[model samples]
Target chain A: MNDQLIALFITFILVAIIVVIGFMSGRDKKVRSSVEEWSVGGRNFGGLLVWFLVGADLYTAYTFLGLTSSAYTSGSLIFFAIPYSILAYFISYFFLPKLWAVAKEYRFTTLADYARGRFDSKLLSALIAIVGVLMLIPYICLQLSGLQDTLQVAGKGYINVQVIVIVSFLLVGLYTFFSGIKGPTYTAIIKDILVWAIMLFMIVSLPMIHFNGWNPMISHITKEAPQLLTIPSSGPKAFPWFITSAIVSALALFMWAHAATGVFTAKSANAIRKNAMFLPLYNIILTLVIFLGFIAYMVLPKGTNPRFALLELIHMSYGGVAQGLAYATIALASLIPCSIMAVGASNLFANNIYRDLINPSVNGARLTMITRCMVFVVIGLALLFGIFFPTALVSLQLLGVAGMVQIFPAIVFSLFWKKQTREATIAGLVVGVIVTFSMYFAGKSFGINEGFWGLVSNIVILLLLNPFFSKRAGTNAIKQFLFQK
Target chain B: MRKVLLIILIALPIISQLIALPFVNSIHPIIVGLPFFHFWLVLWIFLTPLCTWGIYALQKAEGSID
Candidate 1:
């Protein structure tokens, strides 16, 4: 009956009320029978809804929680997120529009479908789907793990971790199961609204109230953690590997199955394109998320979990309704993405795995049902993992990013390279994955992100090996792709 | 068959931890605004795009040269 726990309960109730209303309203039980309807809100979201959904999807709970923790600990190193994300959007703008054009034209539901279209290889498309789905499960695990950490931080011994994780996300899973895309999409509207309000409020309010301004705080950070304020003393994130990893994340951002499904929900490519232009403003909230990290650093015990920095900041700063709202926002930050990721992962399973393999004869409704089932199953596993090996969350997320990036050459290169045979793509994917992972472990042997090293090895091997695997493509397939365009 | 191969493929991360990698070194990066852990994400946001675009440019260069 502690005040914090009571506040959390109130926050949960508010979230529940909103979610139930969303689910009850958005669900079309009769329409849930088809892939187009179930997986994608009937291919019908406008620019605004799609903008918020994809924005929220790309930035998740960990973005706020983990990035802030990075700022708190390392200082300037967290700046890497800005470049990586910006790179993701710009590159996506150029290519994703084409990808979407073809997707809408063909009613393509997965990136695998696009691969199948461009490369004329179902196997390649399916392989991409598999990697996308598997990589995403671990990523979802990180979100749940983050939510677990946040609740533990918020409730502070009043609630059990496992029960909280299970109960909190059960609503997310249920709402998503019934409402499908609209559930996450609707919740995302509220989430983005809150994100804008809180981000702007804290960004201006905190600096004005506390350190007088951002300059003094910047100076304070420099005095405390100068290394964090600038790039590595060795140089601006040196080694070829850093650059390679950055590029890989950018290309890999949209390669995920969720990005594809997220786009499919868009009414047009223009929406995705427009969202790309200003979504960086959401990076505006990012500054506050970073600020919260430093504020936590300034206040909390170092031994305390860095992941709880946002929750602790709210508790320390504002005590009543603000604390409750802040706690809910952090939870929903993870919750919204958790549902979207699970849906994407499960859709991959239902479409690419079950329909493609287990039962080629499966119907759309059946596939949709299987997709919903997989969401709970994935979240269930993440819940178990959250309760157990918590520290692995960061590694799991990095691994997911690394694994997902392996598909970039296979997916993106196919757009321009008509001669890219299935053999070349398969070979490139395999080699790219092996090299990326190999370098990841190699890089992490110390303490840095292995993604950089892994991506370097992956791309080099891919570019070098792809041409040799397919010196020439069959003329018919080339005619099909080129003339089709 | 492809999906099955993917299941095996996803195992790369787990297997990776078993083996040692080369070129590893520590910077002992000092703490900052967020924490030692999360700050790199911001830097990552900025640097990753620049670096990635560099690679894309490299890829473009490689393509044009060929």
Candidate 2:
């Protein structure tokens, strides 16, 4: 058999193993009994499991492929991921433990649940749930595209890539419905291990084998394309953009629904804190991935599509089995996170929107089933959206981060500040979302990040309007959220 | 004193990444063959965790965490 076929065969075998693992993960009948149990593994995971789950959940195929491709095209701009991740953990170190505490006390299953319980406003809860689901769809679509790119490289014109993507997503949707968070949590261990091993091996050995050594690879880039080595001081993605993007992304990291889902799964507040301290270890691998991008730039021929830089490089360099294994790693990277994201989005819809608003009388068992069924709906929407309007999804995916950060005030401020008012938060969210989208569409941000502008307006409105609404501040729920433990 | 220290530990990553960018945003003076820009970011990737660990230690000592 040819190289592509050999690689394809290996990828199929590995993917099959993971699918089986996903199916068998929810063997315990308890995992299927309630929304909480199914959505968060009954919130009993220790630090290690949370670490693996969050690690696998956050670093999707998009990060792997997108970072490398960004490095290939824009040079040092991609390095924003490194610092943002570091800053994210630092921020999470403070807030997530507290948030987890309140979540545990209130039986909060989603961020919307936290908002609803904190502010005593179902309107705010439904708004947050809608925003979470909307932001998450584009992100899920991103993973699909990542999967599509991996298949295209591996199949090499012999196989149908779209059919495989849809089938794989359907399989993921099925297991996610049956196994709930447990499937992704358990399967995440396998995904993280494979990703770390393969990525580390590739980063260390690829340059040495291809360019004789790391020093020589650096020298080649320095001599040929020196600008690839440093962040440009003035331009669209200049130093200002870099700094703002990092800070904005850091602030927005934990606000993503999937990220909160990962946090809510931890057994203890201390588990979240410990995970924060250790999670930066994943950044080490991230830095290496960025380096892989630089390496791809050096090795791949000019005019190659930047999106396929890393995958194409692997295809050219490795044999069939190695290529297949690499492709499978990327594919699983997409699949695992997509499953977690679907769960996160589905939980928001079922818990906050359907149960709280539409039918307050829904039973726990029925709620669990509703959440499970919403998994397919979420994945199906993302798949259809990806197929019909790929470019729109890409642009919206850019807005996803800026858009999700709008919730920062509503969720984070209500945690510590006793004077935080729901009226101000809702006003801020409205202004923030409007400003973020308008700035993005207007094509003018004064070279600063659009999210930064949105957040500024959002905070300004929040602070200015807060004192007027102080009468409703410092409710019993706020006190409970603050000192619950 | 503990609160001040914890605040500083948290701010270390932000300072290194955002505040110190312009000063370190250059390709010259490669360290161990990495551009100083790359080297600085990679250094903080490792060091940021230690900062978090410091905060963790302080919080643990204060009995804020078990």
Candidate 3:
């Protein structure tokens, strides 16, 4: 067989193993009779399980491909991911444990659930849920793009990439529908192990394979592409964009509903805290992961699409089996997180939209089923969006981060600021979202991330109007929420 | 002490940006084949967790953890 066929054969075996693992993970877990069990894994996950789940949930295929691509195409701007994630873990260190506590006490399954109870407003909860689902759809699509990139590189000309992409996601969707959080959590272990091994292997081998050594490679790149090592190298990614994007993206990281689901699954507040402490270890590998792109910069010809830089580099460097393993890692990166994201979005739909708004009388089993079906719907929408609107993938993903960060004022701030009223928060959210889109659409980041600008308006509105609104509404509800501690 | 470490943890990421630490962003001092800026950030990625562990340990000791 040719290299493509061998790679395909290996990929099929790896994917089959993942699917079996995904399905079998749900077998021994508690009977998922309710939406809670399916959505949050019965909220009994220990530190290691939570670590794998949240780590996989946070670091997607996008992190693998996108960072390498950015580092290849642009310069030091890709460093935004490192500090941003570090800041995210730091910020979550303070709030996630508390959020977990409140979530457990109140039986909260989604961020919207917390918003509803915190603000005593179903509209606010529904609004948060709607925004989450909307933002997550594009993120899910971005994962599909990640998978597509891997398949395109690995399959080459022998396999129909589109068919495989759709079929692979459909398989992931099925397992997610059947197994929910457990599916992803189990698969995450395998994915993380592969990711670590592959990343370590590449970090060690790629430099040696391409150049004589690391210093010579650095010297060669510095001599040839000096600007690749610097920031603002004739690109839109200025220093201000780097700094503000890091802050906003960090805040936005845990705001995703899937991230919230990951945190909620932790068995204790201490687990969340401990996870935060250790999560950065995973990120260290990520810092090393970017070296793959730097290696690509030297090996690949100019004008190669940066998105395909990493995979193509692997294709050029390694044998069919190694390439298959790398391809499967990226594919699993997409699948594992997509499963969690689907579960998260569907939970919001079934709980916040259907139960809260449409039918309060819906029982638990039916709710579980609705969430299960909504998993298909969510992934289906993302797939359609990925297929139809391919060009806008990067922008939509950025906008998703921008839009989701707008929820910080309503969700994170309310944890401490008991004086924040639903009116003020709703107004802030509306204004923040509007400002985020307007700035993005109008091409006005002013060198900072568009989302940080939105957050400014969000906080301003909340600070200005919250006192006025909360006095009339009274802090009784807010006091009740705070007193729940 | 925990409060101070928490503040430091939150501030470290932005402080490098806000001040534009010249010594950190330069390319001359490459540690482990990484630029100073990259190395600085990666250093913090490893350190932030230690800081977090300190805060967690302190909080646990105080028995204020919930």
Candidate 4:
């Protein structure tokens, strides 16, 4: 335990060092002096940086720990994760390029910008902003929780979870506040390097090292825990929850402020399209990670907290150095996305609410300053909530996905549906949100996930009501949309 | 050609899963050594770049710049 604690301490120090160095790279105080610099990295990311930045941001701690826990507990159902990312990239490829085109034409920065620009509706934009900020809080909490869990297990004897969370965020906030998007941008390069090495090495080495080969390992898992290889839950309990969660996750993934944040950073709409084309290879690395989760389940003891499978596997087999590398990778995984998510949520408040609503006369520098301050506030709230609520990481994650996904029709569909009136979009959004929340809370109380119920009602209300308002958008709107090409 | 390639790429995963689990179960050689699902995803990734590049070239020649 003391050894694990030391290892975790070393990992924390490494992240602090990397982040500070990255932040120091933003020495051109001229660039660091504006919202464009702070929020979107001066609106300049080439394919190389964009690839790593988007890759690191999208493939998150949830991918690292949450998916593994699922693969460990359930079986082939984990395959849903791999395919959906492919589908997500495909969907984003078509829609995002068009979005990028519109954004460039109008100088739109956030998804709220795009929403308002398309609908000519400030109320709809505000509503989108509200939903985005609301969903962002829990997402940040989950990242902090992932950091906390990793530290708690990796450094059990010496440091406390609260201290690790505090130290990690403090370092994270300092760099993000100083450098904004560029801080995470540079660090992502390091993150991906470690990610690629560790992912490739483990997928190739451990199966052969621990159990002879892939086939033999699968045979071992089947003999030991056959249920781990198939969807184990029956009825509405596990399977329905799992299936609904998958669909919901795939739908909501890009709606998160960070997804758009990444999208907005690309060089062109076409770059967004091209990156989306090849993005699922990242999923292959994720496959290795998820499979490692099952391998851990087959090997680890009964109550081994399933979340720490990858780190523990490295530790148990390879000892402290490799464990340190794995621990550092997961820790930074949480940290980089933590910075990005906080920054995204901060931008929504600064650009949409504070600038658009409260002041309307604030300068870009002041807006950037407010965003930094709001980021601190967002991170503070997340840490407090994570410590106080401490429910389950998986549940908080699902709720995050479910909540954000409720915006899918509004954001994704609106781009191609210019006839989507601001008023009608709001009507659908409001009704969709209400049904989603009511079902979510009612189901959650009854020991089921709230999202499944909420989404069902939300989708029904949206489809049932869309046609009634569809005709109001007019012929001009239809021509703009149906002929976007 | 582009649409057909993407369909084949996307279709590989669903098809490979059927082959890998509950069915053949030991049918190797999706690409010789890669497991069926992993192999199919790799194929998808490899084909995606080629497909997109071709589509990009075609679109450029057709003046679809925006």
Candidate 5:
């Protein structure tokens, strides 16, 4: 068989195995009886499972694609990815334990659930949920683009990439709908293992194949394209941009609904803390993984779309089964996180929007059914966005992160500060989102990320409104939250 | 002591990026195939977890693991 056929065969078998794993994950457990169990594995996950679940949830195919692409095009600015994640783990170490405790006490399923309980405002929680679901659509679409890019590399001329993306996400949507969070938790283990193996192989072997050694490869690139190895001083990605981007991205990372869902699944606050302590080890591998982008830049021809650089290099270096393995890895990376995001989005819809506002009397089982159905709706919407407006994927994802950063005041800060009123938080979120969007359109980097400006405005509004709002019962809620342990 | 340790654990990663990067932003003195800036970041990437583990140990000692 030809190279394409070999790739197609390996990818086909791997996809089949992943799909089977998805369907079989929740079979031995009891029936998912409520939105709680369906969305968060009944909140009984130990540290190791929560680690894989969040690892899979946070590091999407975009993580691999986006990081290497940054390395290929930008340079040392790629350092933003690692530091942000390290800071995210450290920050979450402090707060996630507390958040997990309160979430468990209140039986919260999503971040929106926590906001409502903590702030005593269902309207604020509903707004948080709307931003979450809206932001996640583009994120899910980004994963679809990852899948689309992988299939394009693997299938070559034989298959239509669009059909493959639709079918693959359809398979993901089905299992997520059937098994909910359990499906992604099990598949995450497989996905993480495959990603590690393939990435390590490419990282080690590609440099050897091109320049005979890693050091030689870097030295040669340094001699030829010195700018690719050094950090920038001015223009779009300068030092200030890196600092602000790292800080803002770290602040926003765990604020995403899917990440919060992962935290809520842990069996205890200690489990979450332990998981955070060790999470940086994953970033060590991630820091090394971006070297693949540098290697690709050194070897591949100029002007290759930085996004496609890594796959194209693999196809060039190892023509047949190895190429298939890399493509299969990327595809699984996309699908695994797609499953987690579907559960996160659906839970927000069922618990916060539908049950909270539309049908106040909805039972737990009925809500589970609604969440499962909403999983399809979420996937369909993502699919529509992925197909019709493919070019908007990058901007939408950046905007999604900025938009998500707006919620930090509502969900995370409210856990600590007692004086945070619902109205103040709502204003901060609204104004912060507007600032983030306007900054993006007006071409006003001003040496920092737009998300930082959004966060600044968010905190500003919160502080400006703090003194005006008199003491309320919410002050006691923080005391209760602290003394509960 | 716990508060100092927690602050160190969180601040170490951020300080490394915002302070250390611009200070050591150069391509020379390539250590083990990586530039000085890359070496600095990678070294701390491995170290940040140790600081985090230290914080976790303190939390456990205080009986405040949560």
Candidate 6:
């Protein structure tokens, strides 16, 4: 057989294995009895499982492919991912434990549940749920596009990439419907192990194979394209944009529904803390993956599509089995996260929007059913959007982050600040979402990240309006929430 | 004093990443065959976890993690 066919065969075999693993992960029927169990693995995961789950959930195929592509095209701008990840863990080190404790106390399946219970506002909960589902569409699309790019490189125009993406996503949707968070949590271990092993091997060996050594590759970049080595001091992706994007992206990381789902799955606050302490080790692999982009720059011919830079490089360098294994790793990277994202988004919709607003009388089993079914809807919508728009994956994912970060005031602030009010949070979120999108569309953000502008406006409105509304709202529940556990 | 130390530990990674960017954003004085810009970030990828580890130890000692 030819290289493409052999690679495609191996990729399919690996994909099938993960799919079976995903299904078997939900073998315990008790997991499907309640929304909480299905959405967050009954909150039973220890530190290692939580680490793999959050690692797989946060670092998607987008991180693997899009970061490299960004490195290839825009150079040092992609390095924001490293610092943002570090900052995210630092921030999570403090807030996630508290959020997990409150979540445990209330059986909160989603962040929206916390908003509803803490702020005493179903409307705010529904709004957060809606915003979360909406923002996650682009993110899930990012995973689909990442999968699509991987398939496109492996297929080499012989296979129908679109059909494979739809089928793969449907498989993800099915397992997520059956297994929920457990599906991804279990499969994530295999995916993370493969990702770390393959990425490390590629980074260390690829330089040796292509350019004789790491020093030679650096010398080649310095001699040929030194600009790829440094962030520009001016322009849209200048130093200010880099700093703001890192800070804003870090702030927004946990706001994503899938991330919160990962956090809520931990068995104890200590598990969450320990995971935060160790998760940065994954960033070492991520830094290596970003260097693959530089390797692609040195090796791949000019005018190659930057989106396929790393995949195409793998195809060119490695044999059929190795290339296929690498492709499968990327594919699982997409599938595992897509499943978790589907669970998180569906939980938000079912618990916050459907139950709280439409039917307060819904039973636990039925709520779990609705959340499971909504998994298909979320994945289907993301598949559709990804097929049609298919913009630059990194920017779209960032745009999603920009919108999701608007929820920081509503979610994070109410954790510590006793004076927070639902009215201010609601109003601020509305304004923040609007400003974030308008700034994105208006095409001028004065060299700062669009999310930064939205956050500024979001915070200003929160502070100014919070005092006025604090007098009317009661603080007893706030005190209870603070003192819980 | 512990709180101040914790705050500084948290700030160390962000400062090294953002506040110290311009000074270290150079292609010269390559360390281990990497440009200073990339070297600094990669070095922190390892060090930032140490910072988080410090914070974890402190928090554990302060009875925050039990």
Which has the greatest lDDT? 2
The TM-score values for the models, in the order shown, are 0.82, 0.98, 0.96, 0.87, 0.96, 0.97
Once fitted onto the true fold, the runs of candidate 4 whose alpha carbons sit more than 4 angstroms away are A1-10, A232-234, A237-245, A444-485, B1-62
lDDT of 4 at A103: 65
Which tens-of-lDDT digit does each residue in A4-45 have in candidate 5? Answer: 899888988998899988988768545367777888888999
User: Between which residue pairs do clashes occur in model 2?
Assistant: none
* Best model per TM-score: 2
Candidate 2 on A1-485: residue-level lDDT in tens?
Answer: 98889999988898889899999997888888988898888999999999999999999999899889889998888888888888988888878988998899888889999998888889899999999999999999999999999998888788899999999999999999989999999889999999999998898789987899888888888898888888887777787888888888899999998999999999998899889888988998888898899888888899999989999889888968888988999999999999999999999999999987899899888889999999999999999999998868556876899888999999998788878888999999999999998999999898888998999999999999999999856557557648566
Give candidate 4's whole-model lDDT: 0.71
User: How many backbone clashes does every candidate have?
Assistant: 46, 0, 0, 2, 0, 0
- Every candidate's lDDT: 0.67, 0.89, 0.85, 0.71, 0.84, 0.89
Candidate 5 ranges with C-alpha deviation above 4 Å: A28-31, A472-479, A483-485, B1-10
| Candidate with best DockQ | 2
User: Looking at model 2 chain B, which ten-residue stretch has the lowest summed lDDT?
Assistant: B57-66
What is the DockQ of the complex in model 2?
0.82
Docking class of 2: high
**What is the DockQ score of candidate 3, to 2 decimals?**
0.62
**Candidate 3 local lDDT, B1-66, one digit each (tens):** 667766675666557544553346666678888777777877777677777777677777788875
| Candidate 1 global TM-score | 0.82
Question: Residues B1-66, candidate 5, lDDT per residue (tens digit)?
Answer: 778877877677667767777888888899977888788778877787788888778777888652
Candidate 5 chain A, poorest ten consecutive residues by summed lDDT: A470-479
Cα miss at A84, model 3 (Å)? Answer: 0.1
Second chain TM-score per prediction? 0.42, 0.91, 0.68, 0.52, 0.78, 0.91
Error of 2 at A317 (Å): 0.9
* DockQ score of each predicted structure, in the order shown: 0.05, 0.82, 0.62, 0.25, 0.72, 0.80
CAPRI-wise, candidate 1 is incorrect
lDDT of 1 by residue, A1-485 (tens): 66676667867776676667657745567536666776777777888888788877877878888888887776655655654565567567567766676677777788776676677666776788788877887778878877777777677767787786888788888877777777788788888888778777776666655677765765576577556544454543433334444555666788777777788888876676665554544564665676667766776777876766667777777766777777777777888888878778778777777776568797766777787787788788777776686677787676788788777777667766765667756876777677667756665423334554555555566666667766665655433644474
